[model samples]
Target: MEKIARQGLLYDFYGALLTEHQRHVYEDVVFYDLSLSEIAEEQGISRQGVHDLIKRCNKILESYEEKLHLVEKFEQTKKLAREIQSLTKAFSENRDMGLIHRIEEISGEIVELEAH
Candidate 1:
């Protein structure tokens, strides 16, 4: 489930770079987690068409990620956020002053990434 969420985020990041048609079908099927039949009905296409468009869009998005690495950077940001959360939790429980400072720094870094 966690892996799915991570992949979904990466897909969304890469999806922003796709064409409108690709975005329409890909967003419906992937980001919304809709079934092929559901997407087909919504998009006025056959199930097979939706499936093929999704497959092609996936390839395009993957290619974009391979070259631009935005999705990779986004994943790294997610991992960093998790690590910062853990650090914050530990500092809260232990009242470690040094850990508090580190957490604050990391939190700032995560916020900066959010801007990008």
Candidate 2:
């Protein structure tokens, strides 16, 4: 993924663990698309401080992901869901037994993942 998209995904998964100030600053940069200078002006901090905060927040969030793997599991589940949807669509068009079997197997995997 691109830097911003990866940041956004990580934030979506792990941002609530951040302190209120860190969450606010992170939201401004990732969600609101504010520059460091704008964020610094709004927060009464230096531009370099804002930059350092974002850098640190990225590391913090990534470390959580490295330890927990929630983001990775989520991506895997989402990919499986999309694949199942496509397979179902193909089954509807072709009435293929192979597609149906694959969909059933993927459904079992999805169920097993949810159990964790």
In order, candidate lDDTs are: 0.78, 0.95
Error of 2 at 60 (Å): 0.6
Q: Looking at candidate 2, what is the lDDT of residue 12?
A: 93
What is the Cα root-mean-square deviation between model 2 and the actual structure?
Answer: 0.9
Model 2, 10-85: lDDT tens digits are: 9999999999999999999999999889999999999999999999999999999999999999999999999999
Q: How many steric overlaps does candidate 2 have? A: 0
Model 1: residues >4 Å from true position, as ranges? 1-7, 41-44, 98-116
Q: Give the TM-score of candidate 1.
A: 0.64
Poorest 10 consecutive residues by lDDT, candidate 1: 1-10
Clashes found in each candidate (C-alpha, N, C closer than 3 A): 0, 0
Q: Per-residue CA lDDT of candidate 1, range 1-116, in tens?
A: 47556557657677667788878777777677899999889889999999888778767766776787876777678888888889888987998899878878888888888777
